[model samples]
Target: MTAVADLFNLKGQTALITGGSSGLGLQIAEALGTQGARVVISARKADVLESAQAHLAGLDVDASWIAADNAREDHVERLANDAMERLGKIDILVNNAGATWGAATADHPLSAWDKVMNLNVRAIFLLTQQIGRLSMIPNRYGRVINVASIAGLKGNGPTSQPTIAYNTSKGAVVNFTRALAGEWGKYGITVNALAPGFFPSKMTRGMIEKVGIEKLAERAPLQRIGDDDDLKGAALLFASDAGKHITGQILAVDGGVTAV
Candidate 1:
């Protein structure tokens, strides 16, 4: 006899979002926080994390943040432990931290390739493992939201900005979501991913400038790029009880671009 709205209510839940200082991470934090979940955000820079915490407060969202680079193992371990200490238990996790590099395959530096793969793939596995083992697995209840990209779903030709490493890393993330979802379901945890299209963020600034926002928008049937709020609904669904029966799914929030 649960009320319809009660399914989406997160009054007692808590979430930890990596790379949450800005962009889509910030947006997802807002979505979950506004719905009544305590939120903790993490990123590499202290100043930016402070700013994001302040912004969340302005929205009346109970939010906190930690400054940590997910690319490093030490930082990942500390982030997981500290977040659990701060929130008691994490009912939801958003693996939103990521990195990208743009270079032709031939000229792509090995160091840069390592950087992208480390953050986009390795960091995700580590954090998810830490959080899952410590919190989610013990509770037998959890939600994991991975932030993937449309680039992972398809390949880009030479005409577009060359980002082979970034693309490859994201593709790994897509499959990682599927593989983990299959394994974790037995533990009463649901793992899902969000594959977003072009949005106005620091990560996409270069691509947007090179191709023009209008041009990118035209690629989608919606004829518009994603807005700040585009991911809120889908994010909420996967985080709440509304998505209890769903897992191993990658929902694309790309304004119909992938549909075409």
Candidate 2:
């Protein structure tokens, strides 16, 4: 009696996505919102959050936003509280807010390293804990989708760009997803991660400029870079009942870059 297309229906669910103002975060937000989830996006900038909210409106997606820095403990707490207040309940949580600093390992600044870790890893842990405790656990159901990167799966060659801290933090996310899934399974929460390769975003603009888009595309077996729609299906799967039985998994949304 369940239609195949109905498996992905999220008409009554709600999602909270951090760093959702732009880049991969915004893309994921669009996917969930269009699929029928009431979405609440958060980031550090009010201006950008407003823009993203407007963009979602244009697409006829039900959406709202909060501007808060996830790197701060107080801000994280407030964000989780405010999102639940606005959305009524959070059925899905997307930890997509992240930062990166490009520098050789030995020359990387301790301050920058801390900054990246605080945002990319620690923020995720804190938000997940709070949201899980307050909403998902009590409800006995939830979906957590972490936006890791392909950089976490492998080390950059000696000649590659130096982003030691960024890579390290993302690697932590991969394990974090697995560990959290193991612990949260009892609560009916499914935790998984998406490790994306070369996507055109503010974060990767510099790298794409340095390496050239054609060269980067060549690195993938598909011989092309990822586009807007590439991550939608995978995101929908993890956030929907379709992935109820799937957890603790890491899916690489690269054009087969990690395979080779």
Candidate 3:
């Protein structure tokens, strides 16, 4: 039997994480890197990437950063190629970059919808396809982690801010993770998704403020929102050998909000 420690060990592995300069992406990066994976994080800002890189360095992690706007196809392509060149191979890919737009369905603009879908759904598909073809398929080994949301599981109540486009895009991601997992399992690649509830970040800052953190926390059975270290273990499981038998699954890291 494999030792417990070895199951989660990621020594010598390489991971590429999108939107990894902060929030949940950076948390996941820290988990994988501290566990022994060489991590490369990407975001749209070079300055932010530099700060995240330095933060990881403080933890004694082998971490690098690349600045790329993942919503752009050309940038996504270049990111894949550049990461391949730098890491030689990508053992794990975390599709965490996404955007959201808040507007009632009746008032939503077509352009805003396009922007949300492009970043949240289209970019994930493109990056995963490129990474699979460039590395995972040929190597016959990979772990793909898609960062979805609890919003995808169900609709928001009447009182909440209308985020129809964001919800719709995340719903697409939910199915995308399952569909890709089924198709790619034959190639020895396992695909899974993490459906997180409210976590305080740049993306959710406005929402949190609008709803009030205490009120939001009351909805969950746990009576609290997620914290920095909350996502680390779950992410590490999916990214490491610990979760080799797990695929085509969506695990909600949402304070048990979806449960009740």
Candidate 4:
């Protein structure tokens, strides 16, 4: 049997993370890098990527960054090619770049819906297709971790923000994980998703302020929101050999909010 430590060891592997300049994307980047993987992170802001690279360097992680806007097809294509060139072969891909727009279903603008879908769903499809075709399929070994949300698993209650477009896009991502896993498993590529609940990040700052962190905590059985390190173990599991047999699964990192 492979030793447990060996299962989780990523010493020689490499990863590409989207929206990795900050928030949960950076969090996952830290997890993968600390575990000995060389990582290439992408986001739209060059300055932010520079800061993230410095932070990773401080942690002794071999890291690089490519700035690209996933919402644009041309940028996404360039990001894929650039990341592959830097890493040589991407053994893992983390689809963490996304967006959210808050508005009542009736009041939501069509442009906002497109924005959310373009970043949250279409970008994922495009980048994953590029990486899989470029590196994973040829090598026949890969791990894909998509960042979904607990919101995708269920509908919003009366007290929650309307966020019709955001909810719809994340729901698409949940199934997208399953469908892609099935299609790629034959090629020895594993696809899975991490459905995180309320965490303090730039994207959720407005919601947290409106809903109040205490109120949000009350909704979960754990009585607390996610912290900086909460997603590390789960993400590392899915990215490493430890989760090789695990595919087409959605692991919710919510603080037991979905349970109740």
* Candidate 1 residue-wise lDDT, 161-222, digit = tens: 88999889989999999999999999999999999998999998988888899999888899
- The residue-level lDDT of candidate 2 at 211 comes to 90
Clashing pairs in 1: none
Give me the runs in candidate 4 sitting further than 4 Å from their true place: none
Task: For candidate 3, give the lDDT of residue 37.
Answer: 96
TM-score of 4: 0.99
> Which 10 consecutive positions of candidate 3 have the poorest summed lDDT?
207-216
lDDT of each: 0.95, 0.95, 0.96, 0.94
Candidate with better lDDT, 2 vs 3: 3
How many angstroms is residue 64 displaced in model 3 relative to the true structure, after the best TM-score fit?
Answer: 0.7
Specify the highest-lDDT model's number.
3
What TM-score, over all chains together, does every model reach? 0.98, 0.98, 0.99, 0.99
Q: lDDT per residue, candidate 4, 1-260, as tens digits?
A: 99999899999999999989999999999999999999999999999999999999999999999999999999989999999888899999999999999899988999999999999999999999999999999999999999999989999999788888888899999999999999999999999999999999999998788879998899889999999999999999999999999999999999998988
In angstroms, give how far residue 142 of model 4 lies from its true place. 0.7
Identify the runs in model 1 with alpha carbons over 4 angstroms from their true place.
none
lDDT per residue, candidate 2, 79-163, as tens digits?
9999989988899999999999999888999999999999999999999999998899999999999999999999997778889
In terms of lDDT, model 4 sits at 0.94
Off by over 4 Å in 3: none
Query: C-alpha displacement of 23 in model 1, angstroms?
Result: 0.3
lDDT value, residue 8 of candidate 2: 94
